[model samples]
Target: MSVFSDIFFGGLFQGSLYAMMAVGLALVWTTIGVFNFSHGVFMMLGAYFAWQLVAFGLPVVIAFPLAVIVMAGAGWILQASVVRPLIGRPNIVLVVVITTLAAGSLIENGALTVWGPRSKQLPSLIEGNTTIAGVGVSLHQIAIIVITPLILAALWSFLNRTRLGLALRAVAQNEDASQLVGLNVTALYGLAFAIAASLAGLAGIFMGGYRFMNPSMGADPLLKALIVVVFGGISSISGPIFAAYLIGFFEAASNYYFGLYWTPALLFLVLIATLMVRPEGIFASRSRGLA
Candidate 1:
């Protein structure tokens, strides 16, 4: 019973974090019609920025928002300058590869130049532990668990209720039609990228509490985000969230029963099985926009 509780609660904690990261990646892909390979760098930048701010005596509350705002600005700049130039080009694949490689190089070298090659840690917002139904958990972990759903809910409301949100959805559905209807498609794309980058920033801040931040820290979340996006279905918003929790639970269970070495293998097997059973994802039908 204790083991089960640990796995269940622990998986939920980690899964929620992954969902935050994956949702941002999905948003960029679905709304802007570009697969942002540099998303991992955005996350890395957020973590590093938060660390730097906090080190300068800023509160976590202030630092988090600052990091997000900076990343949002960076996203806007990237869209306006680099991505926009390739918009009408016939070879989108080449553009994607070039952008990704450029982003990778920029992030790595920028971090090394700015912060040097060292791992940094952000202070936890919530300290100590709490118990639930006789299960013990860290307060920081609980904050992560709570924040994930709140962010998701906020995003859902924004995308479904606001005028700008509706415009974004329209742009995602058909850029040409959206432009014909007087929507500034380019601005919408920039907004989408900004929102996505903001979400990634939040994920980075949360990640810093639990893990050390370095240039390479983004790699794990990047891989996990890709898996969750694929497993959940690219076109569906809720799919990646569900898939994240599922993968988290599977990882916890594998670690508990078979030891740490087999965890990756187990997860890959589950991914294979999931693909075989539901290639379109378990919640693929709920996908918004064109099918």
Candidate 2:
């Protein structure tokens, strides 16, 4: 029973991280109509930024915000420079592939040039551990579990209640109509990219606390984010959050009962089964074509 509880809660914690990581990817897709393959690289950059700040004797609080701000600025620049130039091109697939390759090469080369190819650790924002219902867990993990939902709630409120949020939603619903109504589509895209980058930066900070940071760490999270987005349905924000927990639980359980190597196999099997069962995704409201 204790083992089950540990797995359950631990899964929830990990799921929250995955959800945070994937939300940015989903936002860019839903709002900007672009599949940003570079989202994970932004996360990598955030972690590196935070690590560098800590190395320079900055506190975690300051480092965190600095990382976010830097990444947000980077997002703005990427949009203005790279993405902006590709606007109105029919070959979106080419653009996505090119951006992805560029992100990967840039991160790899940048890390090698600047920080070298060494993995580094960051100080945990929350220290110590606590026992909950007979299960011992790290307080940092607990903090992640707590913080993820609060961020999500805040995001929900931002999108639902704020004027810019409503405008973003309007753009997502009908870009042509939004433009007709005098919305700056280009500015909206930039905002979407900024928000997406911010979310990724948050995930990077959380990840840095949970584990070590390296240049290549983004690859796994990037793959997981993509899977979560697909599993949750491309159009529904709620779907990714829910599916992230599901995937997390499955991964934890698989790691516990079977070998760690089997976890990926199990995840793939479950993903395949899920697609077979619900082609549009569990929480997907409409077909992909309609979305």
Candidate 3:
């Protein structure tokens, strides 16, 4: 029972975090039709930004939100400076994958130079532990579990209920048509990046509180998120969220039964099998436009 509890709660916690990270990756893919390889670095940067703010004696409440805001700006700058200029180029998707990979490396090095390869952690939003169904769990873990759904809900509302969201969706559906309709495609592109970055930033804060963080910490989460995005489906938000939880449970079980070192290999094997079965993703939406 204790072991079961651990796996259950552990998978739930991991699922929530993966959902947070993978959704942002899916958003960028759906919006711009390309992956932002630097996204994991964006998560790392967000954590550092919060850590720096807290180091200066700010409260977690202030630091966390400020970190998210800073990440939004960073995302916008990334799109405007690097991605936007490459628009309309032949084979833009291939170009973007290369450029963003380079950009991710540059940002990771920058974090290493500034943070000096040391691991850092954030103060927990709620410190202490509580028992659930005869199992001990950190309150912080419960908080992450509770808060993630809220964040995703708010994001869903923002993307589905607002005028700006409608415009963004329009751009995602057809950039040329959106431009023809006076939707300001370039600005929407930046907005997409901004939103994706902010989500990644929030995910970073969650991870920082969950475990120690380092410059390269984002790499693992990034890889996992990519797998989730690919396995879940890149065409819509729901796909990644569903995939996150499934993979989360699978990972927890694998870690328990197989050990940590073998988990990644198992995941890749599952991914390979999944791809062999469904190349378009398991939950990939038939109807698109970020829906």
Q: Give model 2's TM-score versus the native structure.
A: 0.95
Worst 10 residues of 2 by lDDT: 282-291
Predictions in order: lDDT: 0.82, 0.83, 0.91
Model 1 residue runs over 4 Å out of place are 133-135, 286-291
Candidate 2 per-residue C-alpha lDDT over 103-199 given as tens digits, one digit per residue, 9 for 90 to 100: 6578767876899877787777799988997899888888889989999988888889999988988888889999999999889888888888888
Candidate 2, superposed: residue stretches over 4 Å from native: 287-291
Measured over all alpha carbons after superposition, the RMSD of each candidate to the real structure, in angstroms, is: 2.1, 1.6, 1.9
Model 3 agreement with the true structure over 207-251: per-residue lDDT tens digits: 899799999888988999999999998987888998999999999
Q: Provide the TM-score for each candidate, comma-separated.
A: 0.93, 0.95, 0.96
Off by over 4 Å in 3: 286-291
Candidate 3's displacement at residue 151, Å, is 0.4
lDDT of 1 at 82: 69
Model 1 residue 231 distance off true place after TM-score fit, in angstroms = 0.5
